[model samples]
Target: MIHRSISEYFSPYTLQKVEVDGKEGYVLIDREGYYKGPDEGIDIALKLLLAYGDAGIQKALDDENKSIHLENMGFDFQKTGRYVRHGKPVYKRGEFDLFKRVWSFHCGFCGKKVSIDVQPEYWYIVDQHGIRKSNTLSDRACSEICAKHIWDEYLELWLKNNRYSTELGK
Candidate 1:
């Protein structure tokens, strides 16, 4: 498993907060500016190593400073940041646009053609390989916004059915 010194684990880029149920939760992100140039190379290498173990993280550490220089050898991982392993899109248009985008999504479904939106403001993917609708599809701009209603409903139902499991996090 990946491990870090207490200081590295609690770095500013890492976010920590108490959940609604009072459990601590956190995540990391590659901080901006600090992740430029050589840091980019290190980031790629470290990610690959994360799959195996913290061997990469340890190797990246500096002999004198003892700091890994994550920005140089890996991501400036933060507990809070914008990137997500899997994120949807959110649109900025009016309700009419949302409906229109849905109509287009339906059309694509009916036509059996892939439709996709390239811009974050129009994400509307039906599936991993479905069309992109980041422009016309409000769901494509942001995944959470697109899936919030459905996800919330499903989660509510699941929680109700599985009352014994009483923990959740963001």
Candidate 2:
């Protein structure tokens, strides 16, 4: 059993209301920069930040600072790395650390060991559907071969259930 508080996981930051482009929204302030999102309340914003994870939130802040620096230097667009989608800056997604944390596990298909020796690309994390815990996966594959085999089996079931109505009538 792990005991932890919400505050324990979050980095020190301040939340406040701010106006951007004549529209009101909330911003979270930290040492690096502020995170601006929709006009959602403070609680929702906090939840969003928490879901993004500490490292992700820091990345967003750093990206924002970099953007500001470039704009100040008269660059119309960022030099590299940052992505803009539909006129808003899109931050990079953080690397999922679950694989590293649960390093010692048997392949869900063949019961093979998944380790650093087994190149990272070969392994797959299969998120189980309809499970009680979101933190865990229903199955994992130690190699690409196992993953494809498992997916092929799953696809058969999916096709059976999702067949066209006309095809079923025939």
Index of the highest-TM-score prediction: 2
Give the lDDT of residue 59 in candidate 1: 43
Q: What lDDT tens digits, residue by residue, belong to model 2 across residues 2-94?
A: 233787656666676779999996566664665634543467667877767666666666666654544543334333221222343222212
* Best-matching candidate per lDDT: 2
Error of 1 at 14 (Å): 44
Q: 1-170, model 1: which lDDT tens digit per residue?
A: 24567776754343324365677743344455232344655665587577547655544443323224323322222432212112322212222243355332322212222233422232233332111223233232233344444333333444345341223323
Compute the lDDT for candidate 1: 0.35
Per-model CA lDDT versus the true structure? 0.35, 0.48
